[model samples]
Target: MKVTKEEVAYIAKLSNLMLTPEQAEKQAEEFSNILNHFDTINQENLTGIEMYSFEDEPLRLRKDEAIPFKNSDELYANTKSMQETAIKIPKVVE
Candidate 1:
């Protein structure tokens, strides 16, 4: 499963990637090494391995509670400017 320079170049072209000759050669070597690692993994023994599952654990969630605000004056006290009942911010777009 060793990746060739030509294969890498073809893949880069298909992906619209602009790679120099040196970069393509380097990427090809990297891809070949990765494929070799996968080949090694495929030869491992896993006869009695138990598949991992997340169904046994209970999900801990916080209780949603409603807290009341003191007043509008207290909330808007730190604003740069304010209209009748809302905070006034500078215009961002035309």
Candidate 2:
């Protein structure tokens, strides 16, 4: 799983990156090392290992509480322009 400089350059181009020749070489070597590590992981024996499983009982989740902000009135009061409940802003886009 050796990564080449050309492949690194291609990846850089796809990711909108401008890598120097040295940087490309370094990245290629680093990527190759990463692939080698993956290859090493693939060669491991985990036949006796059990997969993760959730409990039979339903998962308990915290209630989604809505805490009201008290300073909303003060925020709107400081604004010069407000439409109804929301603060008004000038449109910048066409």
Which residue pairs clash in candidate 1?
Answer: none
Q: List the residue pairs that clash in candidate 2.
A: none
lDDT tens digits, residues 1-94, model 1?
8888889999999999888889989999999989988898778898888898668987778889877787978887888888877777778898
Counted clashes in each candidate structure: 0, 0
Q: Stretches of candidate 1 above 4 Å error?
A: 44-94
For each candidate in the order shown, give its overall lDDT on alpha carbons. 0.87, 0.90
Summing lDDT over every window of 10 consecutive residues in candidate 1, give the lowest-scoring window: 52-61
lDDT, candidate 2, equals: 0.90
Name the lDDT value of residue 42 in candidate 1.
78
TM-score of each: 0.42, 0.45
Question: By lDDT, who's the top model here?
Answer: 2
**lDDT (Cα, tens digit) per residue for candidate 2, span 3-60:** 9999999999999999999999999999999998889878889898878656677778
Residue 89 miss distance in model 2 (angstroms): 22
